[model samples]
Target: MMSQKLAASCHCGSVKFTVELSEGGFDTIRRCNCSFCRMRGAVVVSAPLTGITVLEGQERLTEYRFNTQQAVHFFCSVCGIYTFHQRRSNPEQYGVNVACIEGISPFDFASVDVTDGVHHPSDGSSGGVVGRLLYRPVEKDK
Candidate 1:
């Protein structure tokens, strides 16, 4: 897919930004079973390190790291919402929170690949999908 730019922000709108998706665009979406990711629970799409530009509330952004501390997770301090993260698997790219993207929702995807972050590849293990998340929207009455 062609590269595309999308607006994104935290729940409180305190952190506004733009993300230029990688060549795969939304098709790069996936989830991780890591301790932090499992708790934050955000579906993510891919973007290069330079692809994201924070338009506002730069100071209100906070970062968190765990275990290997290779991946840096960013969130809106004002509303405490996960916005994106530097990928441990690929530091040159980021895994942007799909929910933070305008006009997009985590439920929009039918199925998402769940990577085995518990046994991270960086730790010398062959990381792979452990499961899949399925979204089934209910039918509405006419």
Candidate 2:
């Protein structure tokens, strides 16, 4: 599929970035059922590290690290939006927050695959192989 470029930004527009989508669209969005991800409840799409360019508010971005610390999450200090993160499973790619991307909505996906991140192999804990398939249908106006 042809790659497509999309612009993303924090809730307050403090941090802005552009990402190139290899899948061309939201066809590859996913969710991780890990402690951090589960709590944030974000849908993410992956892109090569080079595919992302920080256009603004670099200094205002804050990082969060834990556990293996391989996966570094970046959020806007102002609006506290989780814009993107370095993937733990694949450090070569970044997981861009789908909600931050312009002109796209999480409700656009018919189903999002939830990875069993709670049982991530790096944690050395036996996280079960179970996965959850989630679907959120948008409610129409009355």
Candidate 3:
């Protein structure tokens, strides 16, 4: 598995950036069933802050913070597309929107595991972050 540089942008193209994908590709993508994430509905892949480079449109990006305000969500003000966010769990990394990455689709994933954001470790809620795994069936040869 070789790491690849991926291009990402907002729906209106007001925001553009590049991210270095992990060698395993979308295998690292995950979803969160937390109040905010459940509504945002974007599958995310992790990348080190150093791996993400905002190429343009930084001024057009809006930031939203809530709860502990540790997690910072970035969205395109013009297109209202969620591009990525600074992970609350790991401040040194980011969760990039899988759908925003060019040449990639969320459907490319066979399944995605949902993190138990409701039971976050920071709050000491327990039960672990691996909440539920959603499966997508592919056609099987007869």
Whole-model Cα lDDT per candidate?
0.93, 0.85, 0.86
> Over the stretch 75-139, how does candidate 1's per-residue lDDT look in tens digits?
99999999999999999999999999999999999999999999999989999999999999999
**Which residue pairs collide in model 3, if any?**
none
Candidate 3: 10-residue stretch with minimal lDDT: 126-135
What does the lDDT read for residue 75 in candidate 1? 91
The whole-model C-alpha lDDT of candidate 3 against the native structure comes to: 0.86
Q: Could you tell me which 10 consecutive residues in candidate 2 have the lowest summed lDDT?
A: 125-134
TM per prediction = 0.95, 0.86, 0.88
lDDT head-to-head 2 vs 3, winner: 3
Look at candidate 1 and tell me the lDDT of residue 13: 100
lDDT of 1: 0.93
Ranking by lDDT: 1, 3, 2
Superposition error at 54 for model 2 (Å): 0.5
Across 1-142, the per-residue lDDT of candidate 3 in tens digits comes to 4367889999999899999865456777899878999899999998878778889999999999999999999999999999999988879888999999998888877778888898887787773557555557778999
